[model samples]
Target: MDVDDYIGGGSGGGGEALIGMKTVEAPDDGSNCLICLDGGGGGGEKTTTEAWVETPCAHRFHSRCLESWAQVKLGTCPMCRRELTAAAAAATTTAGEDVHVLVADPMVADPLLARWNLFVQRSTDGSRSMSSLVRVLAVSHVLPDEVAAGGAWPPPPPHVVELSFLDNLQVSKAAIQRLFFYDGGSLPPFESVVRSLQSSLAAVLAVFLPLAGKLAYLPEPGDVVIDYSPDAVSPGVKFVEAEYSGSVDDMRRLASDDEHHTEAFLQLVPELEVSMLPAPLLAVQVTRPRDDHAGGGGGAVAVGVAIHHGVADGQSVWQFIKAWAAAARGGSPAGQGLVKLSRVAADVIKGQRTRTFLLRADQIRSLKRRISRRIAAGEPPRETASPVTAYVAIASLVWTSVVRAKPHDAADEAYLMVTADCRRRLRPPIDPGYFGNCVAACYARANVGTLRRGGGDNGGDDEGLARAAAAIGAAIREQLEDPLGGDIEGWLQFHLSLPAARLTAVGSSHRFMAYETDLGWGAPSRVELVSPFARELVMLLGAAGGGVQVSVSLDEAHMDAFETSWFQTAAGDVTV
Candidate 1:
């Protein structure tokens, strides 16, 4: 079905105005209700006297059954699990406005969360409120083992570092959300794991002090800086505890699937309260499967982290995780870390959904072989320094597939934005352990007709793949030569000027080795980015096995097209 049809307003085709519950006579067709498994005509038995309500998806359920379901399941169809209210709101949203509707089950409440909410109410005095399922605690800095031996009441003061131009560019972007899943077979109880993570996190915060600070705007100088003071209210990072009712296998299945479980994953991560300035820059959540009277000793545990984008990039975040893991294992958290700066850009579009595609090691090798043969034919290689690496091959394949999937004018142009790490490319090379943003954006453009014609070579079915790789490789070579070119301050505006429908942006990289992050129990079975900031963004990460995992976000119709085209052209006979 088309995306519009799936999310359309009502049975009568009226938009948002007509989206509400209305009772009507049951259908004459002898279909059983999904919720009760009885004929829709009545509750106890099939009768014509009962009334039913229909969801946007055209599924009918008895009014009483639907009312009970809504209290626990939120606004979704009982049969298909398709979002009703949220999807309708998204469909009716106007340009230049972003709408994020989250519905929680208010009927279920926890005692700990209730106390936290009361504390926040008295502290903020009506200034702010939080969700019920999330309970927050302030984690203060714990002195390292060596320092604590000397009995120091408090550590030295932290630095007041000014934000760079690159850092400011990300001020409006979404916080990075990543979740790590670990098996609980040989691990301690869930409560013990949480205590260990909190202590280790506090230790690591002492080393990376800026992360424990807030982004404060200076009125006099019109500048923003990392403001850290020893005696500030709620002075430490936000630590959260949550519970997921689903089993370990259920979450694993969702993680490995092609489509993203956005809402479920979002709940796993702690929400970064960014509505106010001087906001907490970091928050961490540890979630476990709800106990079913079975001992809670053997289920999956998920550790979710949310960090402000202005504070760090992908490499920096992983470094922090590794250090924290080391500290949790009773090792030193010390590392060669310093803040570095580089540019990034983001834009907003509505109605986007995320999907992941995996390319096996053999498939990657086959792609490289094909591109290598094409470059050897005197076809001026697309990549300058090293042509046809896994990144180039996979990125090009996605770029071409996306362009093919979407509708475009005959004279339209397609642009691909790729980010390159500038740690080693700078004049005075930045340290590999730098704990901040250090990346530059690169652009590649092609006429829609040329891309559609398989790079205008008409060579074979896979010629488009070769052409796309060349363009991406060449863009990397050119941009790396001068990482900071053009008007730096206009970076965000420059990206906004591009045609949104024909533009695609890539985030993260397979070189980050995300699967290696461990917290003493074992390395994570899977790691995923919750929700990308931009609608057209694509994220790349290293799979636990040997390959690249590519996450793409597009509208429903476009995503369907992309999947069909990608598997047919790129995977070909590969069994992945």
Candidate 2:
């Protein structure tokens, strides 16, 4: 039914309004009356000609049956048992001229109902709006058993990494999203999957408790903390159960397609709903295809996870995912490790488009060979250089190709920012399973002319690739030697000072086994990094098959040039 149909006109409208109860004509669709399971024909016979009345909560009943139900001195609907009178009176008073009632009909496919439900579910802080494409079924906080048992839960000291500018910069950005798709053929019922995910998430959150806490800035002490105090309200991770209108294939296509449909992918995940301090550090959404049940359990299901970048880096996030999956399968979660910190900031750009490019294993090997040949011949290498891994080679190729794609002056400096996991590089070394952000950003720079030196559009510029690789290798080596050194406080300012047009930031290493995250039904057919906040950002992930899946965002024109250069370089014709 249309939403306007539920809005009553002034005092005397479509139906009578009793103290707290308002009754309207029921929809003509042959829906059974809640009071009496007859077809709105009271208890006599199943007929569609009988008159029916709808309560404020949208429960419809035969007029006579409802009158009989009211005679029993019950002021509630027979089906849902909601107070019928109070809801109608509040709606009448709040809407003034029109009595606005929320009409929820299972038979009707109404976006208004979906919007209303979403608003009510996430209205805790009143900062989030309703999403039309994704309907929220339920929203609940999953707290660790220790904290939920009711006692003072002490807050941990803020890690220096968490307070650093790098982490602080991510406070206002969108949560990092990773979508995992699975075939539902062998899986249990959809409800069972959701239950397992929630229960296991709680089990896993006990070990990684910080993820369940909030990122709060204490004004008195002038420090930020992962708050989990007993006094805090809803001190737990937000778990959302949602249903996506699109099919599983739709999401798969969006993930694999060269052209990115970001908005569609964003709808699959729950928003973190960050305002100021005390915002949720993590939120998880499990979405089942609308037709999953209709297909008798062969449809696909997607698990979409959103974690605040300030709370955890890629390694920590994946570790949590794998742990949650293991717990879901009745296995014990990985043991908890020590926690630590540091930060950087960036702004979102407009008119940018994202595209994914695949580099086959053979192509990667060929590119590495070409770079090796250049280094062996006459090109000089950095003094303290690291071996040219596939990442180094691919990053260099992308950096050089992008520089050639955009318009830049010959002497203009083009910068490449690469992030490295600092777990092993830190003093005393942090455990690999340690929770929280432990990543440091390293930078490489070269003149525009030097990046585009080969002078041809063929994209076979081995010399340029060699030079770019050397610069990146040196940057990584220098940054790892002292991950926390060199003007750490000014890191954000330094990056902000760089020209956005000439910067290319790389995120998410291929070593983080994303596809290996299995939630019982088998490994994910595909994994996608849906959100790259910066326009010049690039994300590299290990594909389900071999090789790396590179997702890059750039302006329309620049992306076109980059695609041409990229395809020519990594296409089947890679020279060894």
Candidate 3:
């Protein structure tokens, strides 16, 4: 523990590398100082004046943290175990002065670092995901300090975020992951790698200050808001560093929802505090797999991210993760990875076409009135029918029209799958920024004969048109009243057993919050829901001019019918 034992007490003429010397980059993304994590914005000015260092591998670190780490191992890079080779020592050391010198060459190989596989290549190369055999090394909490907005830290606020109908049903946590591999090169020491990550996280906290807050319910009120006053007690995200002993191929096979994957990589999934309220808005794990022969010099590393449903919705999680990655890469989060969501059966949909249409807000108003007028003639459920909106009206029209156009056998059944946004229906409107799932769905069904808009089976009755709208209203009410949480296994099995063409499910929603993510990499190249576990899905997007863009997938036959009936000559479009 003596100073000389760690630093070098003897005369120092050893041409030693600068102990505190480093290369630094200005933080342009409003990230916290790499060292302090919450040093406030303006990385460019602070990094230069305060002094930062960039490793040969391109990671930036604080000069101070490096000095502290040097006490443990003076000659090797705290991150990658490379010997100090690049820049000359920054400290002014005179011959025979009592100064610690790192004289080792940075390029020299170190077996220990190599055995641990300490270095990771920073590239977005399209490859299989990293392995699942990760060994967790440590878990650290990154806190927030500074920034005028970081308010008081611990025991969040008293305001409760009443769970929307959709949120209550979606209590399930979303598990997402991104894998990175080491570009073919020598690895750095473990300290160097962890140091950069820890510091960069500090910078992120300064901007996204609320993330450090957890989910909790106060005594009598029993409500929830991201309760956090930024004092010492406030909590932040948990960062975990893990190592995998397997190869890239082994990882690809294990990262799915299949039974074989059964909690295999569960450790990668962050745990949330469930109770009065699910706590810890977010948790993350970085997994590094063993060396692989593929990619000349790189091995795989998988970054697992877990976000509590009460804390954030899927879109919000996407935004935060991308931001973190961009900060880590020393650039902005650019390039969206949504294009991979599409898995079209080209052969079946070969000649089919997809189109976008607009529906004016006023036109929807008129349609709503039309349905109400028809309902007035019959003994419709006033409670539900009276409250039906233009959205339900349009969905009814499309659903009935498509069924009429299809060639269904007597035994074949048709259904209109519709989802509702619970945000507006809540007693007291929840905050717009409130996270987590807030959607519920309803199914409106009718006999094939009653659904054909122009088929001879209808006998020219009005059963399919106006009546379908009423059924849609009833279904909406049904969804609201239906008790949640049935046998999930049965529910999943039922959907999977259904034929792809028989059911038309929504793919994406207008509320998906697209085009809002900018993780320093710029806009994503593509945004899409990769194919889901089941068949027959649709994607609904907000289109230009207050219209809704319907992205549907079907065989050539069904596409012809669905497209023809999607937009009638009556309604122009619907508000997204």
161-221, model 3: which lDDT tens digit per residue?
4454444333322222222223223323434445655665655555455556555433334
On residues 1-576, what C-alpha lDDT tens digit does candidate 2 reach at each position?
Answer: 323444332221112333323344554443355533335222232344445666666666655555434422234455565554433555634332333333321112113222322442343224234445666778888886556655434445442224544464344345687887677477666787887788888777766666776766553443455665545435577788777767767655654567876666666666665534466678888877766654325667778888887677788788888888888878877654322332321222357888777777877887887777777766745453457899998898789889989888888888899999888887787655666667888999877887776523244557777788888988888889998788642564365445656788999988877777777777776677866566578898886456787888888779888876676666553211
Worst 10 residues of 1 by lDDT: 8-17
Higher-scoring candidate on TM-score, 2 or 3: 2
TM-score of candidate 1 on Cα atoms, chains taken together: 0.70
Give the lDDT ranking, best first. Answer: 2, 1, 3
Which residue pairs in candidate 2 collide? 20-85, 21-85, 161-341, 161-342, 162-342, 165-343, 165-344, 166-343, 166-344, 167-343
Estimate the TM-score for candidate 3.
0.40
User: Candidate 2 — number of clashing residue pairs?
Assistant: 10
Score every model by TM-score. Answer: 0.70, 0.70, 0.40
- How many pairs of residues in model 3 come into backbone collision? 62
lDDT of each: 0.63, 0.64, 0.44
Candidate 3 off by > 4 Å: 1-357, 362-384, 401-406, 422-433, 454-463, 482-501, 507-534, 555-557, 568-576
Worst 10 residues of 2 by lDDT: 104-113
